[model samples]
Target: MKKICLTIIMGLVIVFLNGCEKVLEKTPDGQTTIDKVLNDFARSKGLIDAAYNEVYQARDQIAFVFSPLESLTDNAFWAATYNPYRWHNGSLSLSDPVITWDWSSPNDQLWSDFWRGIRLANNAIKYLPQSTVITEEQRAEWIAEARVLRCWYYMQLLEFYGPMPWIEEPIEPNYAGWNELVRPGYDEIVTRLESELLDVINANIFKPRVGAVDAKRVTNGIAYAIRARLLLYNASPLNNPENDRTKWQRAADAAQDVIDLPSYRLVPMSEYKRLFIGANTTPVDEIIWRAWTDNSHINNTNGVDVGSYPFASISHMWNCGESPSQELVDAFEMTNGALPVTYNDATHTTVTVTPEAAALGYSEATGGDPYSNRDARFYINIVHNMYNYGVPYNCTEPYIIETFVGGRNGFNDVISQETQRSCPGYYSGKDKQVKYWGPGNSGEGNEPTHWVLFRLAEFYLQKAEALCELGDPDAAATALNVIRERALQPRIQDVPGFANTQEFLRERIRNERRVEYCLEGQYRFIDQRRWKILNETNRFITGMRITKGGNGQFSYQRKKIRDYQSYTDKYLVMPIPLEDAKKMTSMLQPKAWQ
Candidate 1:
């Protein structure tokens, strides 16, 4: 009887150990095993494509990544009760779950999503080496691509949370303390990211551009542009305590690397707007890297960036979330490349008549048509009161946006009128219009906007900025001219009242970035932080209050919309999430976050 019991126990132990081994298997859930993926080139390609799909898969990819964050800067306003709004309004605490220290369960929050991407990249890198079906050269190239994708994830994290816990190797789910891992210092994180990117560049694995099949894949130009941006951030006041010139030089050189690449150039001014809103397959040389999506995955609903539209135009389902502030509207230079509309005070409601604005049919005394006689991009980027966009290709009647009080689509008027009949921009057939996509019978509008990641124009701006910092304003002006001339505006050197001093060039570069990249991403907020001008530039958000008289005359007042007076140096580097902070008790929060 004793011998029989011993045999049963021994058998049970063997079974238990086998089950444990099965649990530790390397195959990811819902994915094929590494052995199977590596044995076939088709499977390997699918694996790579899976990583790409993961990036563009977020339900609110653009809003989550870019739009809502615009509220943090002077460029936009967000009224929605979303994570980004909470962060923008400074309502987030250390205990906020989305950004907190607890990393146990991987949710779809920004922190978790990015960390998951890093894991996918690491897994791909690990599995690619085992492939016997592909050439060694192909394996090396694919591995480099994986590393670049990983670097991209890290870059996004760096922008929001500053230094994150760097994950060099793939951590198993069962690994102890994986949830509470502590992060390295800012410098250490930057160093590792720079090293990884350089290794890929040195390997010559990425191309300056990719074919249509691989439209948005990480390329040599994209990698270099990111490196340039990262170096610029590192060299800025936010990171460089001593304001290092070497870092600036490094950044300028990296940007030049992309500029030297002969594959890209600016699209004509005529085609500039189409680059963002055109069909998915429409080729544009200006886009360096984009999160490409097609009609099947397109924004069928009104949610991609509904905030970009005026409040009165959208239907009942969507709210006007993002509107251009008066500050942003004034940043656009005059048609002749003159200074922005001069204001009597910070209110910006009263414009001091300039020869430039008047030359383009602006009236100085009555605050002239603030929208008239601005850069061509202003017409493309913003929709102001009473501006009539040309007739839609599908519709014979031109669409006029009426945002004045008591007018159709007026913010206040629409609120009082329950019936949307008060809104009269267009009832249907808006796709023919170039600037907007209004709600039709289906309560939906489609505007296929590609969230541009990097472009050739930005590189020129980056080069111009670094050169200015290095006290080469002449060279900087030459670089800035590349964009200005492309926009059909006078070169900075030719502008009548323009000064050649460093101070003048610095302001010019700042203005150029704000106008060129507004509503595209977090560039405005990040740039303000780096330049240490949050107090002056981001403190009080402003918007236009439009009142339309019975005579169809429009009146405007630049009102201070939100008082973000709480902004300070600490906001420059966002704090680590609360739950994550709690788990890693020894890890210190970013300076002043404590």
Candidate 2:
């Protein structure tokens, strides 16, 4: 292992790394590196943070326009030229243009990152208990934390690349038969992860919940949350191809376990936006796992950043890196609980709306600003034409987002100097953009935030989806209404035709997830996959082209950004990177990809 000193170990493990350099530090020939590193508690504890660092670094893949996950989904359009856009269309490969040769900094090859994280978590587990300085209580908690963290990374891998080879223990430096492994089935993957987490939960070692002071650490809450999410995905169309009701029931039960946890609850709708950006010393248990940049990679004196893309978009320095899509904006229902628009086809040309909603004055028509009185989450998440952006922390004046033709945030017909020029119609909203610029909002870019991973609202919907699939529509509606009510929208049962059938209720729950988790980490991206609905969500993308009139009113029309046929059957699950897949021999690639 030391001879190769490979950045990625032979198996899916990252044994030694210091920016993939030959040696993180040197020692005498007889002093093996692991022994040197595990000499004390401080160094052993650092291993835990290092594992956490792997996931935190992966967050950069979605930060700004670098390698945004939302760009691959229908939610946001990343128009910057800094990185290749092929990934957005499912063509990112070894030949990808801007990222063709480099996988070091952007860290876009997540397969490596996930395994690196697992290896580190395993390192902590194996070494921490052996440390003389750690007390029994600390040892127990640290072991649980490492196990849960490892499962979290596995969950991510399963979500992205489907089932993987099960590796429980850290690969010893001298273990040589890594290539003998083969990918397991989803059932084995689920059993292994579920059993492992259940073991921890039963051990009663994990903190029931962590305060904002310790928010980033793994807690009992997240183990249940992760298990719920994993099982929910496992029960979805892509993973459960059998339409397994039992799996759905398992998913529902797992989500219920999270709900049973007393500490976690939705931070009121009023606090939703702030929950994503502001620091909370005493968090209200809204978020289950709020991962933050732990100072290993990013430097931030202020609260942790929510990954920095939604900064005041009109600023010259922070140009509109990501333009929220019209498709996503349309998904947000009118505040009165009427869907603003529906499409005859996924291309987004044919639009329709409820005539009842229209008669009551809720409309998506562009006769004027169509963003009025929408879902509470809508206002919290998107910066529309008249919405404020680019405001200074101290300034009394507000800078309105101007995305009309020839406006400050204009439409780009090409790759131009003004990045905002390419904006569709809206920018992502993090109203605290003013406060997140840097230390005390000093116009620098690194602002730390609690950056939510698993949250109560997500579990609500997860429970709803699983219950719906398990043939318990009423119970699912109960969970679904929790989210709807929190968003200040009408309940699912109250929505006219939505309660008429299980299928209708299912669709309603899905749409809630669409808007509720808009532009959030891979939620939309993976949902479309597991639901097997890419034909509907990924066929094409739209940007609202705004033209301003002399009367200072803006007119809008949805324009096709581009059409893609790249979302074929193979894309339901991502293919393992070619370099890594080759080494795994037994599972060269997802069969469809091959």
Off by over 4 Å in 2: 1-32, 57-65, 81-84, 94-108, 208-213, 294-315, 344-346, 360-367, 389-391, 415-418, 430-432, 436-441, 444-448
Model 1 per-residue lDDT at 87:
54
lDDT of 1: 0.62
Q: On a 0 to 1 TM-score scale, where does candidate 2 land against the true structure? A: 0.86
Clashes of 1: 13
After superposing candidate 1 on the true structure, give the runs of residues whose Cα lies further than 4 Å from its correct spot: 1-37, 40-43, 54-67, 83-85, 97-108, 133-137, 173-187, 207-211, 294-317, 342-361, 364-367, 390-394, 413-447
What residue pairs are clashing in model 2? 303-448, 304-448, 304-449, 305-447, 305-448, 305-449, 412-421
Report the CA-based lDDT of candidate 2 relative to the real structure: 0.66
Model 2: per-residue Cα lDDT at residue 189: 92
Candidate 1 C-alpha lDDT tens digits along 96-116: 532322222322255655655
Model 1 alpha-carbon miss at residue 428, Å: 19
Report model 1's TM-score to 2 decimal places: 0.82
Candidate 2: minimum summed lDDT over ten consecutive residues — where? 1-10
